[model samples]
Target: MADELAFKRWKSLEPGIRKKLESNVFCRKCGVTTIVDYEVEYTNSQFTLKGSCQKCHGPVARVVD
Candidate 1:
């Protein structure tokens, strides 16, 4: 119930905020800032972006503040 509401609110975030969040990750395995996709999720009352490194396919995650 509440989870769904939070998810919906996340979906309504501004495009610029999403873009900034999606672009601010460095891929350790690839040694580059190449994050192609961001999977936004809410956990423990915090939002996170789960993505993969485009060059090396390594896991990348960033906490949204």
Candidate 2:
């Protein structure tokens, strides 16, 4: 896990990169675009995302650091 403050900094990245990450990212189980938030965890080894889909209303992806 990474420091919360550092994770906040990662969240402040440029919008273009953020969008690219969001699009390329997906749910671990569903393999869908359910990620609402994205961040590097454990020194960039893993990406944690938060948020759920508006259509399915299922378990939304959320940053889990």
Candidate 3:
């Protein structure tokens, strides 16, 4: 799907769907988007993604897939 549609679909999905799609989520860290190696935790209707930037030490955006 297109990036916009993908993001919309992700947002429209239920919590269970979010859990299943966690593997596809990526971290927009540094100048590159990288997949997180560790498992993501979902709670309180929100996700706390723990990952680092691949190119720089700056923070990254948590993207859902």
Candidate 4:
């Protein structure tokens, strides 16, 4: 993502939305909550949160509004 948009979107995301997303993500394989490692903020097409399971280190993703 471009730096400008990235910065702008980061600021635009409400704290409640961010926290909801952070708590909602889970590892599909592990079936457990994950720690968000990176996020691809809202764009035209892709919106994702990437992280690893706190217990298993399995990769996980969740779509965010």
Candidate 5:
């Protein structure tokens, strides 16, 4: 689930940038993998994406400034 403000900010980004961010997540089990089923969160003045890896269906997260 994404908070309202965070989701809004995420939606404001260009599609290409969003694609880059969603496709470039680090997963220990699978190295670099695309993120799926993600949620946007705003905390400590930063945006964090919490989701699962597309390859292995494992938990993954990416922090965006």
Candidate 6:
């Protein structure tokens, strides 16, 4: 919930694209893991997803340009 506009933009993406983004987050503790309970943030004309790792529930983030 960091940025409502960013969240809405993320929601506007196709389901397949969104799934791809969500499932490929790199978690330092868990390697590549699906992201869950994420929030969207927009900065520097890019989208960043901050969330938890699906496997170990550790913090995870991914930047989408």
Of the candidates shown, which would achieve the greatest lDDT relative to the real structure?
5
> Which segments of model 6 are wrong by more than 4 Å?
none
| lDDT of candidate 5 over 27-57, digit per residue (tens) | 9999999999999998887889999999999
lDDT of predicted model 5: 0.93
Which predicted model would earn the best TM-score?
A: 6
Please provide TM-scores, in order, for all candidate models, with all chains considered together: 0.66, 0.45, 0.31, 0.61, 0.90, 0.91
Evaluate residue 41 in candidate 4 and report its C-alpha lDDT on the 0 to 100 scale: 55
Report the C-alpha lDDT of model 1 over 1-65, residue by residue, as the tens digit.
35566558677989788777666777776554546665667877678767787777789887777
Q: Model 6 Cα displacement at 35 (Å)?
A: 0.5
Worst lDDT window (10 residues) for model 5? 1-10
User: Model 6 — TM-score against the truth?
Assistant: 0.91
Q: How do the residues 1-65 of candidate 4 rate in per-residue lDDT, one tens digit apiece?
A: 77457546765778887776666677766664745566455566546666666667777777665
Candidate no. 1 TM-score: 0.66
TM-score (C-alpha) between model 3 and the true structure: 0.31
- What 10-residue stretch in candidate 1 is worst by lDDT? 30-39
Please estimate how well model 1 matches the true structure, expressed as its whole-model Cα lDDT: 0.71
**C-alpha root-mean-square deviation, candidate 5:** 1.9
Clash counts per candidate, in order, are 0, 8, 0, 0, 0, 0
Evaluate model 6: give its lDDT: 0.92
lDDT for 61 (candidate 5): 99
Question: What's the lDDT of the predicted structure labeled candidate 3?
Answer: 0.47
Which has the higher TM-score value, candidate number 1 or candidate number 3?
A: 1
Q: Rank by lDDT, highest first.
A: 5, 6, 1, 4, 2, 3
